[model samples]
Target chain A: MTVQTWTYILVGITFALYIGIAIWSRAGSTKEFYVAGGGVSPLANGMATAADWMSAASFISMAGIIAFAGYDGSVYLMGWTGGYVLLALLLAPYLRKFGKFTVPDFIGDRYYSKTARIVAVFCALIVSFTYVAGQMRGVGLVFSRFLEVDINTGVIIGMIIVLFYAVLGGMKGITYTQVAQYCVLIFAFMVPAIFISIQMTGNPIPQLGMGSTLNDGSGMYLLDKLDGLSTELGFNEYTDGSKSVTDVFMITLALMVGTAGLPHVIVRFFTVKRVKDARKSAGWALLLIAILYTTAPAVSVFARTNMINTVSDQEYASMPAWFKTWEKTKLITFEDKNGDGKIQYVADAKQNELTVDNDIMVLANPEIANLPSWVIALVAAGALAAALSTAAGLLLVISASVSHDLIKKVFKPDISEKGELLAARLSAVVAVVIAGYFGINPPGFVAAVVALAFGLAAASFFPAIVLGIFYKKMNKEGAIAGMVIGISLMIFYMLKFKFGIFDGGKSAVAGLQKDWWFGISPEGFGSIAMLVNFVVSIVILQFTPAPPEDVQEIVEDIRIPSGAGQAVDH
Target chain B: MSDKQKKASAYWRENVRYLFLLLSIWFAVSYGAGILFKEALDTIQIGGFKLGFWFAQQGAIYVFVILIFVYVRLMNKLDKKYGYNE
Candidate 1:
């Protein structure tokens, strides 16, 4: 069968499977909608969390980004995975014991102020919306490339599927469907990587293959060979980083703290039954996530080496079938700047003739290696699974915050359970439409938007939740001031540097890098803003009265972890 | 303070101690070895991989997974000792 036929078969089957799971696990009450009835098994919750956490960025764009960035890419690998340690140790168990359905629920009740809760709800919406837009774009990218459809059409299809499951089953539906997605995505990611590893190094394990000698009897190490090819093309060495050490350090810290602070990931703990289960599930989630995270760098090495060998200095007309197909999608374009028939894939912009989108490296890897059509099709299904699972998870947080925190807690205390569930479903539909709009017109690349979402979460949510649990005397005034200032700082920095809004629009972004504050990129500035938040909150606390005695007791009770009852709405 | 409050404080103290130890390792592996001393560590290589590069991309992630499990085991044991396990 052809690649498109295989993609149709595989994608169709996976969609059916997700819809089937959603229907079977359809939620009836607000409890099931918000926290999956607070009874998910640790193993199952771990699988769901892994799927929810690893989005299209990890599955589709990360290896491609690493292939280009070389050693600088380690910031992503370490920063994203290391955050789980902070989550498991500092956040998960205590939050689970607090026994709330949404992250804003914990913030509101712990701070004992509606103002603090409103700030939290606003941050959650912005972060989740920013993150979900990237997922929708990922879905569109996969559909347009594999199914031979328009990217906008692909996004609409993805939004409909996610809306169906997230609205019907809420957390319950998303959880079970995500488990299936985890299986599909992991299998799809590993198969091509393992095949490429064996083809290049005569080794089955990608991790070892990256460190082993090439299979061609050249006896040269893979990393050394890649480094040679890179410098020959005017690029940096594959094993040496070009980014300043401080920028890398700051970006890593931001991503780590942001991962711990993300509302969707933190809320996963509430689904499990006990505090111990929450801790255990975090371990399982990290192990599963680590499997993909560790293998990505190896795949990066392979794809980069293979890409350079195949495409550089090659004749454009004699290019392979896959190149032509990708060209039709406009993701890979060849411009003969010097009127030369040969394609120049060099690092120099003036001389370079070929432009390949970072997303295509993973999606086209199987085809680039002449793998079977079914393998290529499986990658498409895997990419969809990754994008849809994360989108559904983020949508749930959006709905829960709006329906539970804003409407039920603040606006309408006498609202019925059925009315709240209806509200949640309605908000999810609205969220999906907005997300789909962003999908049709993305602000940036998949990984870049996702990374900024982390920064936002790190600036706004991480400190508040940490202090709420760790510092009993963290008053509402301090938290509210900290969150508002921290998030505002993050947004200002992002607009000025990333979008270049403050420094004469997007065209001036390149020139503005030299003016970065303390030499930190916009992506890394979250750590700085988070520090400011901590300082401001602590300083404000001295002038303000301490938290109520009952609030202090609540903090003490969460620390014990003996009687974490079922997650309740009130 | 009451006996229950005192016992809770001790348990909390022990928990904080474990967090400090585990987080220290986490910081050392990723930030310390992976970034700060990466150039120095890159001088040493194993099986065609630079030490610092391995630490940044592979070693640190493996350590993170282990750290979580270790915390889980320690926390579980502490819960039982403090008569807090369900």
Candidate 2:
């Protein structure tokens, strides 16, 4: 079959599997809907969490970023994975013990203030919506490229499929679907990497192939070859330090904390039965995630080396078929800046030949290596799995924040369980529509916007949640002020650089050396925002009285793994 | 001491200390060796990969996975000791 036909079939089969799973696992009660009835096997929960965490950015854009950025891209790998450690150690178990359906529920109860809960709800919405838009856009891009549809139509089709499973199965249905997605995404990612690794180094294992000597007998390691080629072409060395020390440290720190703080990820811990199970599931999830994360750097190095060697010295008119195909998709463009037919792929600031989108590296790698049509088709399926699984997880968080946190807790405590479930489904549909709109017309690259989402989550929600569990004296006023101030500072810094607010016009920020504070880039400013939140919270709490006696009791109850009665009913 | 009581507190304390030590190593590798003193470490190389680059891209992640496996094994022992075995 043609690549397009194969893509259609693979994607069609995936959709059928997800819908079937949803139908089979349809939740019958509020408990099942919210937390899968707390019956999910630790292994199954681990798989689902892996799928939920690895969004379109991870599947579609991460390798591409590493391919182009070389050593600099390590910030993403370290930050994203390290955050999991923080989550497992510092947050997940206690939150699971608290046994709440939504993050805001924990914050509200812990702080004993309605305003704190409302602030948390708003923060969750902003982070989830911003992150979801990127996932929806990823879905659209995959469909548009492989299925020959417009991006918007692709997004709507994905929306319909997701809505079917998400509304019907709730958390239970989404959990099983995520397991299937994890399979598809990982298989899609590894197949290409294995092919390229064998071709380049005669080693089938991509991770091992990365450090092995090249088969060409050039007396150089694979990474060394890549470093040489990249620097020769005016790019930084493939494995050298390029970013400022402080910026890299801060960005990695922010992303790590942000990953740990994301409510959607933390909520997955609630699906297991006990605190020990929560910890075990975290270990399993990291094991699964590491299989892919470790392989990504290898893929990045191989793709970069292969691309440079193939194209750098070639005449522009003789560019390869893969180049032409990608150029047609607008992912790889030839600027002809020097007006020469021979393309000079070099690292020189002025002599770069191909203006490639880093997002396309992983997707286009199969084509670059001349892999079979089926592998390309598998990539299309993989991208959908990554995007849809994450979109489903984010939508769940948004709906729960509205229905569980705002409506049930604040406005309508008298609502029935059935009424609450319906409200959650309705709110999920609304979130999907809003996310779909932005996905079709993305304002920025997938990875960049996702980093911003992380920044917001880290700055606002993380400190408050961490303090709530660890500090018994933290008060309601302190929690609300911290969240508001944290979120506002993050937004201000992001808008000033992203929208050129400080440059007096809608142009990119000028004089990077002069504009940024303490030489920290926008991506790194999240650590600063989080620091501000922690200090503000502690300082404010000293003036405010401790939480009421009842709240302290709740805190004590949440700390113990046992003797907390079964999870509270919605 | 009671069989259940003997193992529970002892095992739990041991597991916590192990986690603390492992996490400290994780912090040092990624945040310290890779980022803070990266310039110094970059001067060293292994198999054509700079030392700092190796830590950031490959070494730290490999260590993280190993750490998790280590934790799992330790926790399993603790669970058995506490008579919480499934």
TM-scores for the candidates = 0.99, 0.95
Off by over 4 Å in 1: A443-448
Tens digits of per-residue lDDT, candidate 1, A483-524, equal 999999998998899888877888999999999999999999
In candidate 2, what are the lDDT values of residues B11-85, reduced to their tens digit?
545756876887898899899887887778989877756788888988888777677667667666766666554
lDDT of each: 0.94, 0.84
lDDT of 2 by residue, A1-570 (tens): 899999989999999999999999998876777788887888999999999999999999999899988778989999998888878766877788898787888888888888889988999998998899888888888888889898889999999988888888889999999999999999999999999899888889988899888988786799888877777767777777589888899999899999988989988998888877787788888888888998999989888887777777678888777788778779888777787777777666577767888888888889888899999999999999999999999999998898889889999999998898899889988988888888877866444667788899999989998888778788888888888999899999887875566767445665544678888888889999999999999999889888898998676556555543445775
Among these predictions, the greatest DockQ belongs to 1
Evaluate model 2 with DockQ and give the value. Answer: 0.45
Clashing pairs in 2: A233-A346, A233-A347, A233-A348, A234-A347, A234-A348, A235-A347, A316-A342
Query: Relative to the unseen true structure, what is the Cα RMSD of model 1?
Result: 1.0
